[model samples]
Target: MEDTTQLLPILAVHFHNDLGLATANTLAGIYVGVRQVDVTINGIGERAGNASLEEIVMAIKCRGEEVLGGVYTGINTKHIFTTSNMISKIRKSTKNITDGILKNKGTYEFVSAEDVGFIRASEHGIRLGKLSGRHALKIKILELGYNFEEKQLEDLFWRFKSMAGRKKNITDDDLRALILDETIVPQIA
Candidate 1:
């Protein structure tokens, strides 16, 4: 590989993820002095797809300086998430590219959402379901600008439990509706 790089100084390596080794192979090429790499957004290709731009870029960004002998790419890491999301949208795939981004950005992600042009939505992180507890409900209620006493919170918890049993997931809008429906004083006819 070094000999080939010496011969063709401007050579670029193309990788296919047939056996899920494209990113690994591409990194190997870089280690062997390959100057360029070929990758596609979301790893979309004919069969098993090519090297994923996100995987490769993030791998380099996170490991290049420390592990890959100081080798690095000129990629803007912040545009990665946005680019992946755009490609997913264009391909009409059902995958939520930024779903992980909405939660704790560091769990499965090594980079920041802002680094990849992704603005995390405020309401996107509130995932309420039947399994959610009183604390979660109280937090969501507070986020919606509602303050309730301990007694009120207990009442809301029961109502939320009943509502959650009847629904698959409780959304922010639904939570707002529940608060209004229960709190509003009706005018006597």
Candidate 2:
């Protein structure tokens, strides 16, 4: 990597998240002296998407001084959340075909699940499965109204993975149960 950088002098890194390693690899590039990176907000791109701008920016912001020897980008860290949300809404608008189905009953043939006395299983309607990443799991944890320290989150993540291996879809109930199990202390008489 260093030899190639020496030869090119202006080498850049661009990666896709098909294997969930794009962000990690991009950071590796920075470590190896690559000064330029091609990134997209929320990792939004073809297929699984490219390296996430938010993730890369936050990682550098949080750990660049200690880990990357003070390397940093010009990204405004505060606007990351808003930008991520905006990009998500844009993507959903393009891909979500069920947007009008809920508003107009006559749009689709199937009966409205809500009208049949059915309610959403989770407030955010998000389910974690095997391929889910740590960022997504953390967001879901926050959405579920629980906060864990880094170590606790690491432990919880492994537990979630174990359950996800067996369960096709991990619902809010399942996550709440896991949280309770981790937090509750048993009294020995």
Candidate 3:
């Protein structure tokens, strides 16, 4: 065992959902000056699970941003969804992980592994809307930007509701283009 103060470069903690180690592992990383973090989405681990990529990234964004001295996250907020898709494709290809949501299409779109940078194969994490208002708005805003006002959002909401009972009624294909546009931020020089 090494002193956590020295910040040993190599430390692998098994993930277990019994205690929610995902959040714990991320905080541990912060406890130590870890530049490179190891994480997976949904905390898929050998036994219980490992830390979640979203948890780590969100923690970094919440705590590391503008603080933690020289700590700077290497994730692009806008590309998060696409990146998750790419990671999923890679995992599927490698047989490391399973695609749980590929069954759902049209309503949303996901990227392929090549879309990210997974030349090799490995298991990774994915992010999605988790029944939270923020998640829904994030999915929308990620694709469409802030162009849609409250009224338009309300309209879309009502439209979704109107089609709620229909077998198939999401005829709005324009939203896909918006999702694709959820990339780099505008250069503000």
Candidate 4:
């Protein structure tokens, strides 16, 4: 509660998707002197969810590399995705707590039935994909994804880009084919 500047020299911003609070929180933390902060992947909360850890991390990189007077943390940035997955499992809601926190944690029924396949790892939910033409492709290659190296991102950009009048964005069917080609086919083919 005592978010005085001295208390937080670095901000671990838990950016929830409400009222643009995540960026605001990180900015506030930075203003208040926070240098490190807590975060999650897609802002998965017990109900309305929290902030996105990936965003704050990238924002730091953007400012550091471009605007923030040459200051970038040499973090193993590739692990950001894995870290997000882990936290989602850790801070996820139980099968109970349907009513509300404090007021409903004890009174409500189990709304989120894990037995029904509502997994703690929320892969079933609406997710981001490199489907917005090359825009998403570049974001995945340069900023997001599992095995993207910064140097390789440029090459990926060119490789995935459209030629002449073609668009090189990923599609739902394209993703399905990739899944079948890489994951499913490998298992059975």
Candidate 5:
């Protein structure tokens, strides 16, 4: 079908993922000069779903220059993560969310989350434990938009130490509560 449509002025491919081949078929269509592709976020569609917008777009982005003769979409890839999250929330499908991209995007993600308008917070990987240092607490405090004096940070550190004893890990939410309840530092914004 793609071969026959190559000579047409406008070519579009509508694919289904019944065999998990929607993305593959879409790529094949593009290679054959298909100008338009039908895709959905997270591949949500009838039955097995359609070609995923993320997968298709990222494929073109990562391979278009080398393989597709520089063919590329005008999409702002950074918003990809934000858009995916919005769609997932709307559909109540949180199972698809993963932090693999957050740690190191290039490992499993083909695109950067920042390109899609999502800003990863500094507290993402910080795990507060009994061995955590005062410097670590200070960094986390600043990252959370708080500016505290040395004395205040010391007080909070002790409070954190007490809490860490009870809980194996102190989460960001817990840290936020400690800052709010114990410290007089004003939130940056």
Candidate 6:
């Protein structure tokens, strides 16, 4: 790989997640001074998928200072979840269209919702659901850049449960709306 880098202007590493080591291999390449890596959002790709962009970015952001000698990507980590959601929705829509043409509900659906970061916080190792505890909610809230007081979190949790009862899945958008509604102060006219 070192000799190959000298031959080319750019030595980008592209690895498939067939053995589920694409992210690790990508980081390995980066460690060896390869700056470019091919990655997909939510790791969705052909076959077993590709290296996860979020995983690589977060790994570098969290450990670059101490472990990787300050190697970092310019990715905005805050948009990771939203980008995953958008990709998941697009994939789902494409699956729906292909399913209609193929006359099979899952003919074009290769990845699971959880695999695409839908209804599950795989990075955090927590599955959000109606039965999720306050700790889980608090973690998600903090991840979304909201720092509510203890009492507010408690109140929000109850409201979350109320909304959760009606919906099969409460997405980040739902949570944001719930937070906004719960925290908004009404004024006297």
Best by lDDT: 5
Give the range where candidate 1 is weakest over 10 consecutive residues by summed lDDT. 94-103
Q: Model 6, stretches more than 4 Å misplaced?
A: 1-8, 93-166, 169-189
Candidate 5 per-residue C-alpha lDDT over 89-130 given as tens digits, one digit per residue, 9 for 90 to 100: 999984343344334546754465555566755534445689
Task: Give per-model TM-scores.
Answer: 0.63, 0.46, 0.40, 0.35, 0.59, 0.50
Per-residue lDDT of 43 in model 2:
82
Q: How much lDDT does each candidate structure score?
A: 0.78, 0.74, 0.49, 0.46, 0.80, 0.74
**Best model number under TM-score:** 1
In terms of lDDT, model 2 sits at: 0.74
Which 10 consecutive positions of candidate 4 have the poorest summed lDDT?
120-129
Note the residue pairs that clash in candidate 1.
Answer: 78-115, 78-116, 79-116
* Candidate 1 residue lDDT tens string, 6-43: 57557689988899999999988887777689998888
Winner on TM-score between 3 and 6 is 6
126-174 in candidate 2: lDDT tens per residue? 4578866666677688888999998888889999999999999898889
Q: Roughly what TM-score does model 6 have, to 2 decimal places?
A: 0.50
Off by over 4 Å in 5: 1-7, 95-105, 123-173, 176-189
Worst lDDT 10-window in candidate 5: 94-103
Clashes of each: 3, 0, 3, 18, 3, 0
RMSD of each predicted structure: 6.0, 17.9, 14.2, 18.3, 8.8, 13.3
lDDT of 3 by residue, 74-140 (tens): 7765555456667667667322332432334322324434333433221222222222133354344
Pairs clashing within candidate 3:
15-49, 41-125, 143-178
